[model samples]
Target: MNRAVRIGVQIQPQHADYKQIRQAVADAEETGVDIIFNWDHFFPLSGDADGKHFECWTMLGAWAEATSRVEIGALVSCNSYRNPDLLADMARTVDHISGGRLILGIGGGWFQRDYDEYGYEFGTPGTRLADLAQALPRIRARWEKLNPQPLRDIPILIGGGGEKKTLRLVAEHANIWHSFSDAATLARKSAILADHCADVGTDPAHIERSTGVRALQGSSPDDVVGDVLDAGATMFTIGVSGPSYDLGPVREWVAWRDEYNARQG
Candidate 1:
């Protein structure tokens, strides 16, 4: 497959009514974003920590009904929150509802607040990765056993940069790998991921590379786009939030995406 760069917008789900969120999704698709995402957390990860927030899969279920075309999923769902089989079932249901536009973005999880409040274990990182390693196959197996089955083979997006274990799990399971580091760091990790793929006999090209870009950090979308493309990332996401869901940065990204594609062509 050609490694054409794409843009994603994570409508940060904080301090906004569902009505505003719904409109934001519509605006994003209209602006030509390739993917739309929301973080999976019970509470705000940023401003006003106790601000109004929504559940992940449930909001995705709603997104299935609200949006007609754009791919939608969690930025990185906490794998420890729900059982693997149950999560697979939820992904399947959303896939069917969206006519196969769902991506199962998940991770071993790091937020202690969610684990503590939800009664899940706030175990060591290695233990959480171990659980994730076990959960991946079970999720895939359940997808095969489900009655209606998924509308399609759902893509799995794993987020983390752990070289030894996390990247190894990604090599074994992920269809997409999301990381939260700079371009140089991502380049190094991509090489590490390639080594893991070699060890496991899986082609490194089978996994899409995704990374989050912060627009206000004095980096233009085009600048980030160039760095990410050079670093082997195909999917670049910008996270935005508001009581209004300001789309200024998203529009800039969409414009950059068009230019990038045109240049490639």
Candidate 2:
């Protein structure tokens, strides 16, 4: 059977207080979102560049206990930020805490600001992608040796649309592929992914298609939902930022989610 569509909201990790962030997670789960995500960044990605921000994995660890039912993960954790082996253990711990509700969303490091301030090498994109390529295997190997493996296999979500190297790595390693491209770009890239999968003798269908749908002005909740799913995006993730964490948009999307699921039935 074809996999059913689901909605996700990336409570943007910028300009929000913990109280509001926590509330957003609770509300999203209550509203029946399938997943909740936060980005990995040192500073705000939106709003004021120097505005309030929070760390990714720590927030996810908290989200694990604060909400039940909805899966939680980083939109894509930067590989350069932590030791890959350590990252595996961290993910395993969160996976157990969340009762196997963690999706290990990760990617080649971007965001030079994060690297510059944190003392990580702000290498060229090529160098960073190389590091990511090397880390994937190390992370997997450590997971095997770690005392208690992840509560489940803990799905690996790789986000990037790079054709030559990144998607090749996705074909080999990721359980989910997330990219920011529009529908046409997604269709094109997915075909490239299929070819990569074929080259590796792997079944492409095993990797889920995940895409980001940045909320647009004046767009109604129903319109966003309809357009994204119709675009062949099964997993839709909307981003929200704040001092308010105004889940006004999330609430609307959640209502639409209920309707979408009912229609599927």
lDDT tens digits by residue: candidate 1, 1-265 = 5677788999988888888888998898899998999998888888998998877788899999999989999999888999999999999999999999999999999999988998999899999999999999999999999999998889999999999999999899899999887778989999999999999998999899999987775567866666768788888898988678878888888888788788888
User: For residues 31-102, could you state the per-residue lDDT of candidate 2 as single tens digits?
Assistant: 788999999999997668999889999999999999879999999999999999999999999999999999
TM-score of model 2 (CA atoms): 0.94
Q: Which regions of candidate 1 fall more than 4 Å away from where they truly are?
A: 217-219
Computed on alpha carbons, the lDDT of every model, listed in order, comes to 0.89, 0.85
Give candidate 2's error at residue 260 in angstroms.
3.2
Reference-based lDDT, residue 34, model 1: 89
Local error of candidate 1 at 161, Å? 0.5
**Distance (Å) between predicted and true CA of 256, model 1?**
1.0
lDDT of 2: 0.85
In model 1, how large is the Cα lDDT of residue 152? 82
